[model samples]
Target: MELPKDPAMLLSIVNMKLRDFYPTLTTLCEEMEIKETELTERLASIGYEYDADGNQFV
Candidate 1:
């Protein structure tokens, strides 16, 4: 699947996947071919934060 161009949208999609599909950060990153740091950084740039225990963007 194509990654969202917008960081906010990307964060939303990723969080959705985390909530409904993947069970862990490593699984999500591997499946999405995204780096954890890069994803978190991009999300943060758009004012989103990853809650590890919750496994969603906040």
Candidate 2:
């Protein structure tokens, strides 16, 4: 699937995947073809942070 054009929407989708599907950041990033740093930066811009152990945004 294509990444969302809106950053907030993108973050929401990513968080949803993390919460409801994926088990790890690495796996999600690979499936989405997104780099960890880039995804984290984008999410951070929207006030979300990745928690590795929890495997979701906080």
Candidate 3:
């Protein structure tokens, strides 16, 4: 699936999915058909990174 083009929106969507659905970034990427590196890179551009312990991008 195509994610939001805007980083902030992407952060919100991904974080929500993380909070409500996925157990890990890896799981989310696999089930959602997203690239781990690409998602991290996009969110990193906005100064957010995945905290595996918290299971969210903070």
What is the per-residue lDDT of model 2 for residues 1-58, given as tens digits with 9 covering 90 to 100?
8888788888788888988889998899998888989888887887889888888877
lDDT of each: 0.85, 0.86, 0.94
TM-score of 2: 0.82
Give one digit per residue, the lDDT tens place, for model 3 in 1-58. Answer: 6899999999999999999999999999999987899999999998999999999999
When sorted by lDDT, best at the front, the candidate numbers are: 3, 2, 1
Query: What TM-score, over all chains together, does every model reach?
Result: 0.85, 0.82, 0.95
Better-scoring candidate (lDDT), 2 or 3: 3
Model 1 over residues 1-58: C-alpha lDDT tens digits? Answer: 8778899789778988999999987799998788889888888898888788998888
- C-alpha positional error of residue 39 in candidate 2 after TM-score superposition, expressed in Å: 0.7
Regions of candidate 3 where Cα sits further than 4 Å from its true position:
none
The predictions' CA RMSDs to the true structure, in order, are 1.1, 1.3, 0.7
Clashing residue pairs for model 1: none
Candidate 3, residue 10: Cα displacement in angstroms equals: 0.2
- Error in Å for residue 51 of model 2: 1.0
Candidate 3 residue-wise lDDT at 30: 98
lDDT of 3: 0.94
